[model samples]
Target chain A: MNYIKAFAPATVANVACGFDIFGFAIQEPGDTVEIRRRDEPGIVIADITGDEGRLPRSAEKNAVTVVMLHLLKHLGRTDFGCEVVLHKNMPLGSGMGSSAASAVAGVVALNELLGSPLSRKDLLPFAMEGERIASGSAHADNVGPSLLGGFVVIRSYTPLDIFSVPVPEDLYCTLVHPDIEINTKDARYILRNEVSLKNTIAQMGNVAGLVTGLMKSDYELISRSMVDVIIEPVRSILIPSFNEVKKAAIDNGALGCSISGSGPSMFALSRGIENATKAGEAMVRTFAEVGIDATMHLSGINDGGARVLESY
Target chain B: MNYIKAFAPATVANVACGFDIFGFAIQEPGDTVEIRRRDEPGIVIADITGDEGRLPRSAEKNAVTVVMLHLLKHLGRTDFGCEVVLHKNMPLGSGMGSSAASAVAGVVALNELLGSPLSRKDLLPFAMEGERIASGSAHADNVGPSLLGGFVVIRSYTPLDIFSVPVPEDLYCTLVHPDIEINTKDARYILRNEVSLKNTIAQMGNVAGLVTGLMKSDYELISRSMVDVIIEPVRSILIPSFNEVKKAAIDNGALGCSISGSGPSMFALSRGIENATKAGEAMVRTFAEVGIDATMHLSGINDGGARVLESY
Candidate 1:
């Protein structure tokens, strides 16, 4: 019997202000995980590439492999395994959910290949475990959006609260990658252990305003509320021209622009494709102006995360 | 012509966990402002009650009078001079929107009495101004919900992104007003100026969850997210049996409970009026067990801040 195939898109983690509890997926720069049934009845990750030097081929170090183990353990099926292939589509270390996107693709594809035994809701914990393997923390911010697509808010980490927000059809995302690499562990270490009360309040208000901005499709509010008082500043130092690129995207009519995931890549959201293209180009130009060469991609929110493109 | 005859509810400021922004109205207890029309286009406030003679009855020292003046100035009209009598229905020095609720009522009443030139949205700034006179800081946490009648999220103070959440129709707010009072200024001072980044992240996660809870009508999520790590401990100290009552309310099927305003009063929200009644009675009972007498009232979201009761 031929098993199912699934593809999970790349996710943007950290999400500017929300740290580990908020994220969204873009249309381009995603990973594909192909899973096929075997005489074995568990989950397994077969191949890894594009991150040969960085990723683990032994399945123990790979996030996707670990999550599959977690899923099988949770289901009381200790002897379940499947041959999985990870097509590393996006850059290895581009701050665009390079690890999480791959992890999401793994678990989602495996779940579907298992006759869709577990629903998407049920797949969240397994996906979160995959994230935990990569960053030493189980956070759903990136995993949720990568698995579900569009904007997602993660309310909890232990037991994940993942939900999708309605993305207006007109909204599009512009991404700029500066070909720079910043390890997630290094980015996480740069932040302070404590934050000022004033900053915390400001961050909360910004989060609130961002929600309203997304809900009302108010580009101006979205632009204004994208200001992060916490993670980005401390982490962005590792990425060259991060601030300049953000400013450029905003000046180019993007609603709000900020560093994607842990940095080196910046994403801006705009009202339509035209604005999104302009936003992408502007970020690249600004990065170039700062002597940093960057690649920009403009795309809209993908309504579905993983599905069949076609079967041969 | 008579300018006005009724009063508006005093808003409880500093809604728990939503410090500096978020408030709700109490109908049983309120501030009554009586207005009398006069030929001169000059404002006058007379006979301020329940303030222990500490308030200025002569317009200048009175906050509501100043807010009324703000409304007139905002409208660019000089034809609103009238005699304003404020009957402070709720207790003075209570952690409520004693001044803001009055301000909201006077403006709402005056706006209706004066042929409704300004809108409901226009009244927020004036109410905030009224709060500033008492608290010495221009904040919208109290007046926004007071005027709008529901849960509110204030995105920022400088830009003033203030709006209300469409509270679920099934939600019931049970309020417990203890005899003891906590000064708002003192409550504000007692709070720790610095917060840990970990706590702040947790708080932000809760805030995000709470917003989603209200939108999705997920009472469990709302209850889980209604936690405060920054201000609640210090503020709750001023309120008698705050913890016991909150525990009792939660045990009795109330979704979640927290200090209503600054303190001395706490509220529990539940899925239905029956649970709200049980929760309200349980709160009062819990307070009695601790030798603190609290008058608990079961009420729904006002939905009407300061509307005409009979328009005679």
Candidate 2:
């Protein structure tokens, strides 16, 4: 097969108390990449769509091409070449891991076009390199789930140990994306360097609780554990009507609600699609009341992360 | 029946990364309480043993009597009376939750003598009240596991949410108690009020990993997650040759090792009794090399927290 296309879903990171370690993939609003063999000895971006010229046009600067370059270098296939077209289905800078999807799709499709030399897990570091280029730091919380699917927990980062946790089958997410942008770098910079040991203990307790609740399929435990005492208090100030939107989601039957990643996007978890849809509508309506136009997506947890779409 | 006797096992709190929130009960080295009906209208401590007279004699000051009084008051049976005999099977301030076992034993025996009016879980608050008197603050990490058995996670303290997590049947603990003391209050006071956010994130990550490791029975994950970046560094300094002892435990195939609660006592977890015993001997030898005598207790995870020993 000389031509291949792949899709990678978006992810929500920092799931409440699990800052910098927890994340999960969603099914819709993802990115796609189509790769074709080329006679040239280097990778090139042939076309880009849906980014409105906001994403970098240079192949070296884009996450998709960066991932492909890393994967090719690692496989010692530097003489190989590919033409790439990235279709951005998710909004940029929405705190919904848009860049991660693009990077995952690129590497997945390129690996397939190269006759499938690398396993899906083997491609994680290349995708993480793409993340390091997009964000200032190489955090696996987003890209891990986008590549591995389901709920991902990064136990440690030095050796890059990542694993997928069991998520309840009925768990659904309501994502409300307000038409605003918050740069990931700036959002990370605004956080305080130090936190009270008391709050730190509280955060750890909640992290354990959330993971246990997910593993045990305890909805009430999840609801109680879905609290962020450390990051949300600081980052929420940047988002408009953050508290009001969260309250609305909770009132509309969300198990819990918080800023999705950095800002301008909020996610609420519920037991079923009905409650998730209701929470999404409530969150959108709350944003509208604050004079902010917002879009909502309701999706179940995506068990299959990046996948090959078509190959010929 | 006019008399009842009960036993509550010792516990190791903090469990490396889960400071102030995680703990599990052990099978031996626990306290016992014997309760006998009396005609008087107030609780009294009639006898004490194994504490070398270090424990308080005053009913208001002792954890066992204090727990009995609280349980009696909660049940509106303040008009009733009981005579208590306390047995201290563990060392004081050894960080093995000595007081929690005593309190749990008292409540369990008293409740049985009162015809078991309250469930085992319902006795947690009174046990916590005993903790509040023994230590400066009421923390459920110790008492929760001692009362409920197995591994316990205190997700929140405000409404007192506590739950037991699934523990691997083969999981064994090696507890080394040095012949020294470090008051829980003093150890807590020595810790810094604030910690770096970076370390806090690491702590939360490990907490998630440890809880997930226990629930899924993943031994390697448990080893990786049994790290205390926030508390162990500071508290270990108070214990002599702490690093050497921990290294000894790890070198002998122990999964992980750290200060059990506040310090002077260290605990190591292993896959089976053989490894646990080897780890325990190594830790004891290391302490002896530093000229500090230490005693070791090796036991499996106690799924039964507190139980009746005799009733007549």
Candidate 3:
């Protein structure tokens, strides 16, 4: 195939008690990337959409293009050339893993265009490279889920151990994105370098409980385990109407609610579509009451991460 | 029944990565308690064995007697009287959960003697009360598993949410109790009140992985996840030849090795009895080389926690 187009779904990182370790993919509000082989000796960003001309066209500066460059280098296909186009359907800095979606889509499209040389797991390093350039840290919490789908756990970073955890089919997720921006770096900087040992133990317990709940398909256990003791207390301050939105979500029957990744975006899990929809509406209404524009999306857990849309 | 006897198995708490949150019951080296209805209206430690008279006989001072008192109070049977006897088959202050076993046995025996007024789940509070008196903290990591059997996760402490996690049938546990004592109070005091956020996240990842490993029965994942960065570094110093023992266990094909709870006792998990036996021998030899006498027990995960031995 000479050309390929792929779609990568958005993801929610941190997952409350599992900061820097857990994430899950969602179905709506994702990015699409298109790639075409060319006789030229270098990759170029030919066209972009949905970004308001704000994203850089230079391959060196863009997350997707940077990922493509790294993929080529890894595959020893540096001589290969391609024309790339990105459609940024998700808002930037929304805590919905917008950058991860784009990066995943790019590598997936490039991998397909090269006749599928790399396995799906092999694409993770390239996607993580994109994350490093975009977020100033090499974290797999976002990219792992956005690429592998379902719930992903970054078991260890030193040896790059990542695992795809099971998620129940009945579980629905709701994301409410307020029209505000909170830089990932700033949100991270707000956290304390040291955490109380007591809180750390509590967080570990909850994280283990959350994993068990997911594996057992226990909604009540999930609700009880979806608590953050170390990061959310500090980072939630950066987002407008954070507490009110969370309260609205819980009041409307959400299993649990928390800031999606950093802030300006929040998400909740529920057992059914009805509860998810009501929780999303409650969150939106809470943000609207605070004079903030918001958008909401309801989805089941995304089992398929990035995938080829078309081939030519 | 006028008299009842119960046996409570030993427990390995903390489980390396899950300090104060995780534990599992083992099959050997436990405690036995005997309870007999008395004409008087107060609980009393009528006799004791295997403790060399180091344990207090007063109901207010002894963990087993204290648990009985609380159980009686909770059952609105303060008028009820009991003569209690405790046999400490396991060594005290060895991090083998000696007190938890005694507490569990006490409650189990008393509950049986009262014609089973309290259900098994209702017995947790009494066991925790015993723990509070013995360890100066209301931690259920040891007591929960010792009473409930199998693997137990203390999801939360405020509301006392505890879950019995599944244990693989073939998994074997090996514990080596060295001839030394590390008081739980001193061991806890040695811990740093604050932990680095990076290490905290790492610990959380491992805890989640360990839970997943237990659920999925993945031995390699359990081996990789059985790591403790928050507490073991400091507590290991209190146990002589700690590193050598752990290294020997691992070298002899242990799936994982770490301090059983605080110090002086170490445990390892393996998939087969052969590996467990070898690991146990290696641990004993390592301790012996350092002039520290040790005893080893090899057995599978105990699915039955505390049970009535004989009724009269």
Candidate 4:
């Protein structure tokens, strides 16, 4: 095959008290990339769509091409060339892992076109490099889930030990993305450098509970544990009607609701798809009450992360 | 039964990265309590052994009787009285949840004597009252495990939500108590009130990993995740040869080793009893090198927490 097309799912990070540790992928609102091999010696971003000309077009600055370059360099194929086209189906700066999806899709498509040299796990660092260029930090919570699929815990980042945890069969996510934009870097910076030890302990307890709840498929435990004591209290201010939206979701049968990642976007987990839809409508209605437009995506936890779509 | 005797196992709290959340029960070196109905209108500590006259004789101040009184009050039977005897088989202030064992044993024995008014789970807060009297905080990590058995996560303390997690069949604990004494209160006070957000995220990541590891029985994940970036670096100073002892255990095949609660005592988790024993021996020898004698208790995770021993 001279070319390949791939798709990668968007992700939600900092799932409640998990701050930089927890993330999970959703089936819809993802990114797609198409890659074609070239005889010339440099990668190029041939085209882009859905980003409204805001994303950088320069190959070095673009999330998709940067990831492709990293993978090619690692493979000792920097001498080779590729032409990339990114279809950004998800909104950028929505706290929905848009950049992560594009980066993962680019590398997966290129990897598939080049005879599939690396496994999906091997493509993670390349995707993370894409994140580092898009944001100041190379956080894996978004990239890990988008690349690996399912609910993932970035256990440690130094050596990059990340693994996927089990997702409940009936569990569904109601993702509500309000139109307002909150810069990830700014949201992260506003957080205090030092957190109270008491709050930290409480957060750790919830993290433990969340992980255990997911593994055991205990909805009550998950509901009780999905509390973010440290980050949400600060970051929620950046989002419009955050508390009311969360309350609406919770009141409408969401197991737990919180800011999806940095802000402007929120997610609610529910037991079944029907409950998830109801929760999503409640959240959207609450957002509308404050004269803010929002979009909702109802999806199960995506178990297949980035994968080849088709070959030409 | 006019009188009832019960035994409660000792526990290791803060099991590595868990701080105030994670704990598990050990099968040996526990405490026993015997309660007999009396005509007096108040709880009384009739006799005590193995305490070396160090424990409080006043029923209100004693860990065992204090827990019993709390239960009696909760049962609305404050007018009833009981004669209590506690056998403190484990060393106090050794970070082995000695007080928690006494507290749990007392409540369990009295409950059995009074026709088992509450489930083992219901006795947690009363047991924590004993912890509060012994130390300054009503933390449930110790008491939760001592009362419930097996590995447990005290998800929250406000409403007292504590639940047991699964343990691998072959998992064993090597608990090494050094000669030095470290007061839990003093150890806790020495810690800083605030922790860097970076360190807190790292800690939360490890907590998530450890819980997932235990549930999935992924020993490697457990080993990698059993880290305490926030607590251990500060608390370990109170334990002589702490670093060397930890290295010895790790080198000798322990899955992971850390201060067992606020320590002078340490615990190492391993896949099998053989590895646990070797790890224990290495830790003991390391302590001996520092001119501090140490005692080791190697046992599997206790599935039965507190139970009636005899009735007359």
Candidate 5:
């Protein structure tokens, strides 16, 4: 039943204070997964378009291949065979969950091609396994939004419970990606080993506010709750004009603004589409003024992640 | 124009994870205040009951008198004169906002006695000032809940911003007070200065779950989200049968259970009134089985803090 046709969606990761534990997919930015059945029983990955010369074809180091391999092994079909071609539709290592997008797209497409051997919920751990291939640890923030869409909060590490929050009708998101790169690993290493209790409490309050705001669908509360006192202070040092652009975006009437993930990219939220567009423009102008070329996206809240683009 | 009438309601302090920074008032277990116009401009205090002579009467030590003094000074009325009587409603230091209840009752009563000179919002600071007289520092976890009904969260220290969260319709709270006293200061002093980064991140995740749960009105999510990794470990040591009672209440169908405020008191939540009553009984039985007598409250979520019982 391995149809030669399949598709997977793209995602935006590092949602403000949520860091690696939250992410969501965008409608426009997505990957296509077209697979075909073969007599061989191992996963073979081919990186087309979006990934130029940097991606590996080997199944071992590849995130998607690892997950597919695990899936196949679990099904007692280690000899099962399929070749997954990932049209890397999103940028790689751009703080936008580019690699995760690839992994998710591959697994989702393969699963669909195999008549959905695993449920989407059952597929998350495999996706997370793919994430650990690069980040050295599994982080759910990006995987969740990529899979479930909308605002998400992770409640535990050992159990890894993910909670979806109600998105406000007026909610709009703006993403600004500068033409530069900062590896998440380097950024993570730079963080201090310890934080004071006072700062911890402050950060927790902000985190609580952010989650509550999303669930209540209170755009104003969501905007006010976006303050981050922990990772942002240290992480922002890697990105130029982070503060200036944030200030300009808010001044231009954005509800809240912060680094999108580990960035050369940043994000802002607004109560309406018009405000989101304007905020995006404000960010673009601010980043350009600081000598960083940037592009902005004014998008609405996404309610679905990766899905079958044309399922039977 | 002194109406000689005052009132203050019960408050839920240290609400959930906000610990020492959040609280809100209920219409029950409230205190009543009566003030009389005096020939002397300075404040005079008299007629305190329900404290059984274990309370202070000195104007400097009395929470009500201190608040009246602050209010008079704030209003630029040094000649302000009044005689006061207080009805001590809620039990003192029972982790039910006893201190804040008194402070709020005194200030609310004073506000009315002075011909409603200040609105409720304007009166919060002075009531918080009264709390400072006893706690040695200004903290609103007790005062905020005593003044405003429903749920609350506090985010900052300087200038003090309080966030009011929407309570779920099916929300029910059950409280169990053991016959013992464990001071807030003692609970605070037992806590370690440093927390593990891993634990802090876990705490952040749980907080996110909690806030979202409340906003979504997801009782199951709220129940699952009610966990403490930072302060509970240190504070739970002070309360006997803390774990036993918690296990019993939850096993008997409580949504979630945790120590109330500091110590010597604990509370559980449920989705329905019947379940709340069952939770209360379970809490009482658990404590009694461990040879500790306890008073329990099976109650609904209070939305309004205080009202004029009888205005003339």
Candidate 6:
């Protein structure tokens, strides 16, 4: 195939108790990338959409192009070139893994056009390169789930160990993205550099419990275990109406709720789509009551992360 | 059943990645306690053995007596009394959960002598009181597993939530108790009160991975995830020949090795008794080379925590 189109889903990272380690993919509000082979021996961002020309045109400045560059370099296909187009369906800096979705779509499209030279797992480091360029830190919590789909755990980063965690079919996700921006770097900086041993142990216990709860499909345990002791307490202040939104979600039957990724967006989990819908609407209403515009999406766990649309 | 005898197994707390939250029971080298109903309205430590009279006979100072006092108080059986005897088969201050075993046995024997007034789950808080008397902190990492058997995860401490984690039947444990004493308080004091966010995230990742490994019965993942970034780095320095003993255990096919609890005892996990036996021997030899006498025990996960013994 000489050309390919791909779509990658957005993801919610941190997942309450599992900061920097747990995340899961959502089916709606993602990004798309289209790629075509070029005679020139260098990558080019030929066109872009939905970003209002705010993103850079330079290949090095864009997460999608950066991933393509890394992927080609890793494949020893530096002599090959591609013309790329990015369609940003997800809002930027909204903590819905916008950069990760674009990066995953770019590599997935390129991989398909090149006849699938790299496995899905092999492309993680390249996508991580995109994250490094976007956030100044190479974190796989978003990109891993956006690439592999469903629940993903970044087991370790130094040696790059990632694994897929099973999700119960009945579990549904509710995401409320407020009309505000919170940079990932700024959110991370607001956190304490050092956390007490007592808090750390409590955090570990909750993380372990969350994993076990998910594995066992025990919803009560999931609700009880979905607590963040370290990150949310500090970053929640940055997001407007954070407390009210969380309270609304919980009151409307959410199994759990927390700031998704870094902020400006909140995510909740519920056992059924009906409860998820109600929770999502409550979060939106809570934000509206606080004079903040918000949008909500209800989705089941995304089983397919990034995939080719159609080959030509 | 006016008089009852019981034995509780030793436990290895921390389990490398789960400091203050995870522990497992071992079959050998435990503590024995005997209890007899009395008409007098107060608990008493009538006799003691194997501790060289180092322990206090006062109920407020002794872990065994403290557990009995708490148990009776909770049951509103303060009008009832028991005469107790403690036989410490495990060494004192060896980091082999010596105090937790005594506490567990005391509660078990008293429950039996009272015609099983409290369920097994109902007895955790009283055992935690024993831990509080012994370590000055009410931690369930050791006592939970000693009472619940197998691997136990203390999900929370505020409300006292503990759960049993599945153990693979093929898994065997190797423990080496060196002839030295490291006070739990002193060992804990050496650790940093605050840990960096980077290390805490890594710790959370390993803990989640370890739980997943145990649930899925993935041996390789278990080996890879059985790592500690927060506690062992500080505590290992207090244990003599720590590095060499760990190396010997790993070299002999142990899945992982680390200081069992605070210090002076090290534990390793392996797939079979043969590997566990070899690893145990290597740990002993390594300690011997360092001029520290040690005793090794090879055992599987204790499926039964504490049980009533036939009385003479």
For every candidate, the chain B TM-score is: 0.91, 0.99, 0.98, 0.98, 0.94, 0.97
> In model 6 chain A, which range of ten residues has the least summed lDDT?
A66-75
Docking class of 5: medium
Residue pairs in clash, model 3: none
User: What tens digits encode model 1's per-residue C-alpha lDDT throughout B1-312?
Assistant: 465666676565555566775566655566777777777997887577777787877676678888888877888777757888777877666666666777877788777777888788778888888877888777777677777766677778777777666677898878778878777778778878788888887777777777667777878878887888778877777776778888999999898888877767788888999999998899998888878777777777776666554333
User: RMSD to native for every prediction?
Assistant: 2.8, 1.0, 0.9, 1.1, 2.3, 1.4
Q: State the lDDT at A179 in candidate 5.
A: 81
Model 4 misplacement above 4 A: none
> Per-residue alpha-carbon lDDT of model 2 for A42-94, expressed as tens digits?
99889999999888878889888988998898999999988999999989999
Query: Candidate 5 lDDT, tens digit per residue, A160-212?
Result: 68867777778888888888888878877988777777777777777766766
Question: What fraction of native interface contacts does model 3 preserve?
Answer: 0.90
Which residue pairs in candidate 1 have backbone atoms (N, alpha carbon, C) closer than 3 angstroms, thus clashing?
A41-A80, A41-A81, A42-A80, A42-A81, A43-A80, A43-A81, A223-A255, B11-B97, B21-B141, B22-B141
* Residue A154 error, candidate 3, Å: 0.5
Model 5, DockQ value?
A: 0.59
* lDDT digits (tens) for residues B8-42 of candidate 4: 99899999899899999999989999888888778
Assess each model's interface with DockQ, reporting 2 decimals per model: 0.60, 0.92, 0.92, 0.93, 0.59, 0.85
Better of 2 and 6 by TM-score: 2
Q: How far is candidate 5 from the true structure (C-alpha RMSD, Å)?
A: 2.3
Q: Give model 6's DockQ, 2 decimals.
A: 0.85
Error of 5 at A149 (Å): 1.2
**Please, what are the lDDT tens digits per residue for candidate 6 over residues A58-139?**
9988889988988888889999988989999978888999999999999999988888988999998989888888888889
**Tens digits of per-residue lDDT for model 4 on A203-243?**
99899888888888999999999999999999998987888
Q: Which structure is stronger by DockQ: 1 or 6? A: 6
lDDT at B157, model 1: 76
